[model samples]
Target: RKQLLAREMGLEPPATVELQESDKEIDPLQVSVLSVSSFIAQMRTVVGDGEATESARAQAARQLVRLAEAGVPGADPEQWWATQTVAEERPLNNKPRLSPSRIEALLKCPLNAMLKDTADNNSDKYHLVRGNLAHAYMEALGRGADEELARRETVEAFEKIQTSPTWKRAQERDEFEQLLVRTNQWIQETRGVLELVDVEVRVDVESEPGVRITGYMDRLERAVGEGGEEGGLRVIDLKTGSSKPSDEETSAHPQLMAYQLVLAHGELQQEGGLTKVVSSSQGEERDGATLVYPGTDTKKIGTADQARKGDEELAEFAALLPPLLDELAGPRVTARISPECDRCPLKPICPVQAEGKVTTDVNA
Candidate 1:
């Protein structure tokens, strides 16, 4: 139908090109500076190194005291930098989402939302560090490289958080280390079982006419082939945390799903021309994994059943685009005590909470 429409419109679709550039480049300097600075500032407060820079910093310092009293060296400094660098790359603007975390944050607290969206700074408490560690490790593993080395690197990064000099207070450092070791070990075990292929792809897409979304996927693999033409794409979303979310949660989660949708669009450019979804989890230990969907790529139509049933969850997510954009651009009715706020670590700093309660809670 798309081809026919193109013909009717006298347009010839351009040939597809495989992407060559890698994921966002990380400057070693930038990574080191940001991580080291953040870590130092955090440590200084924890040790009462200086007067609290701010209320949040003071809160963190107090929290660190508790961690120390509980016996937690602090995370390895090196690990902290590595993970923090990764965070800077896949930030909100560049990240695609059917249901953005930022949107969820905004729905919960507008002020908290502004801090992240407009200010471009997020409270460290909710930073998805564990998820990122798992993701980084998974990406390395998928490339069929040194798994042990990847594991070690990830562990080291994690340890950086466990053993900072700034954490001079009393706590059970051994206990925290033990937990981290167990967590990483389990992640290593899970990575050991998964199959990965060096499926490199270049995706050239237009988010809308004249606005293109072009990028390359370093690795791709087939988790399941629904037989012949209907097989699906299951792109992995390596996570450091437990993967326990349901299919609904996976489908509803935006980032991972957006990645899947991106992959699907790339697949559609080929002959078999199918919509692919890249699905992955944080890891086995934290829970399991959270799924996310961006959108489909194929212009081809499928059987009504396939369209309605197999892909219904994804379709529904995509349908949310309009409202999401509106909310982002317009004045949002303020609300409070959102159930979503529970998972958010920034709730304390959130101004909406300072105001009052409002809105529908999807989780509720």
Candidate 2:
């Protein structure tokens, strides 16, 4: 009918088209599907075909060259090189120096970790500011500041921090005052046991030759034995947050585990020239790590067994670092949408969040 209409309109009739089903089963190998590179190659063939007009051929050639130079979308050259096989081992362009926070970030969401590092988002979040202030105050107090002096210094530090443009908001100022009061109370309660051997002590370990894991112990205390000799050590981390970490949380805590590993391997003593202290009792060892919530009467202490397990877990994570780093360095990474996304500053720009995978926690 279309051919007859075209003839009546003084135009050439359309060519007859026939539809046919193949006798042979469908073969994926025979299908015509082009990847970016394959499409470029096919275009190059078109460019070289002598039957095509010079202008058409030139256009095809130009497109092929432009695509080749641009390369594939979302393809990382470094990642490709890292994954390729080589005759001799070469040091990676990017070494995987890790910390507990980074490990946790990677576990929660690889995309989050990558974006957090690259994007300058949420640098001045209230939670971050609060946490930093608490850490600074604790560090100063642990360094042997007298009660009167520490309190004054903490206030001064808080004032100094508030001077920053990011923290100048009235609401932040109100929260800061409340946090300061809680911090001061915590200091008074823990003053009796605040004899810290080291404050903000750095622990650096080459878990594997090139895989370096490093973190800082918030406070370290020596346990004196019956003979008045130094016994085991207690690693303590101060928590300003309301939520008290559970026993399970403390047991699997990577930061505390990293500290434990440094102590277990005698690296802490070697690095600081500290004495190797053991428990005074017949069998019990006071050597362990704990998260102390100063304002509250809550403490999450890791058992000796849990400490050992933490060391093992950290070692396993360190061993897996090389490949994990490579994967994260790649352009493609997994973005998990969970309750955590609610607090993630990157949510606005996150593809997964845009897809409506994010949901608010009713309990929260």
Candidate 3:
């Protein structure tokens, strides 16, 4: 009976199938910025079988262009001249060395880095130019830039940009007055906080050959006293935007981590520099900025008052910066998916998504 059963089982032996990974390596090619579809297809091919995978990948590639076009809907031929005029240019290193936003942009997408770094300097849109003038005006008030000139320049710049020439509103005069009032309020508040007065000022400073980092510090206080080293300097950065994040999202924000890393290096190497990012966004209506230090079980709020005290707290915070920076530079044993990916320019080429995996007719 046992022999009969064994023979019966052997009669329907499971089929043995062999799978081999092709040793043939794909050649590395520079992906074209224009050919995002091709980039998606190439990514799928890297991790798939040659046949069915190719067809799936091609379909995926076509979907990307369709999605992108749908998002913008359409382009105008009249604006073609402006678009071509601002064609991508060479990378600029003038990134605010202390701001996490700038660092995060570089890390999240180097292509964005390439785009920003090489941006066409000539495309001076009215709003961008106006905002820049306003920011500079504010910074000048902070830096004590020629007082009369700063005030006059700011007022002149604001008037031209307060509202579009094509726009007419019944409340335009009232709104414009309110803006001037607010600007004056900010200037008055700034005057009180700037005590170092005239000390060769700098922002986004760097020490050569040691480490490469950039940020936009609000001020670099250079006065020496009981709290100051002969070469000691204080770095403070301004935040015009909100600082809150959901509990989970706050933990991995690269901007704050990168800022801490740059400052920490200076602290560790005795470069006499200590940095603090001050959240200056303060108004009943405005959501103030907050600094979420890496690995810290606590969060720091940056009200206008907190920003005022930033210079005083530099020494105390320096002790905490080094360890925090180490956490940032540490090996990543886990991969995290950032939700910010949805709007990321490279979403089409993301390796994890396997987005464009349709088989293609190379002959077609």
Candidate 4:
């Protein structure tokens, strides 16, 4: 403090005081200033994937165009936008590769699926943090990190991610000890029977031309069948949510089925077509999927979903893709009112709920 005061007063500093230069690395706490390109990128996101009116996220198309016209370098609005007739026109991606959960959503209620952001939203920070930490912890474990190290890393990551709003919402989260405990429980649930082959497996399989199923399995494991026989590839999907879907629901789970489909047909995009590493470890047979919930079952492990040998179900799921693709290629989307609609954020403004019909015009 005395040294700083002397320096400020233009007085000679103490001999012991030494100045230090900082390295190129910016502190994580430092808020990043947006460059022109970054501004253009964010503006592109707002105009592209942002909600119909937002959280009221009306697309920022005009702003994007303005940026481009105003000579902002690399500001290509067209690249971000779906092919549209003109500015401010909302057009769907003619061929978007979808996740399995999205396929389920499309099956349940097209309107709700189309309207709701299936991925994380602004207010869902708590779930996002919890899920991320849990996955990271498990992933570390899969990569052979000991219990203590994984726990410490997860807790530290959670603390670093906490902001005022996140802290408030995450009050129920017990300093991530509970999440780590859940992670341990999930690891135990594996029972040493399922050999961990890989973590974070990415797959992009074409159900049909221009219609593809894209998803990431949490982990891939080799299971042992009855009587000590070596089993085929089993996909493990980790869930951090409290709500446990029933066995029947698991059997028909579009997401689980989709992962199975990936096992059967999808290429492991990261590995350049599931090279000898994946192919050698995981034999041809699709041993199906298991939903590992590492959050709710703290006292005792829950009866998690295990959907096996989904060939018939996979066929049915694939069969529906063609018709769904047909719908996507067209302008209008029909909403099949189901339980899923109950959770749609657009329910209040949805035309189906208001006028008993499917229409993008929320006010109508």
Each candidate: what lDDT? 0.41, 0.57, 0.39, 0.64
Question: What is the C-alpha local distance difference test score of candidate 3?
Answer: 0.39
Please say which candidate is ahead in TM-score: 2 or 4: 4
lDDT of the structure predicted as candidate 4:
0.64
Indicate whether candidate 2 or candidate 3 has the larger lDDT: 2
Ranking of predictions according to TM-score? 4, 2, 1, 3
Q: Which regions in candidate 3 have their CA more than 4 angstroms from the true location?
A: 1-101, 107-128, 143-152, 158-165, 168-184, 190-194, 197-210, 214-216, 221-234, 240-337, 345-364
If scored against the real structure, what TM-score would every candidate get? 0.42, 0.55, 0.39, 0.64
Model 3 scores worst on lDDT over the 10 consecutive residues at 280-289
TM-score of the candidate numbered 4? 0.64
Q: How would you encode candidate 3's per-residue C-alpha lDDT over 92-205 as one tens digit per residue?
A: 332323234554554544443334334334333544565455456556766557756876666666566655454553354344333334553543543333333222122232
The lowest-lDDT stretch of 10 consecutive residues in candidate 1 is 301-310
lDDT of 4 by residue, 176-211 (tens): 668677767766777557777778666666655566
RMSD of each: 27.4, 11.4, 17.2, 19.9
Q: How far is candidate 3 from the true structure (C-alpha RMSD, Å)?
A: 17.2
Better of 2 and 3 by TM-score: 2
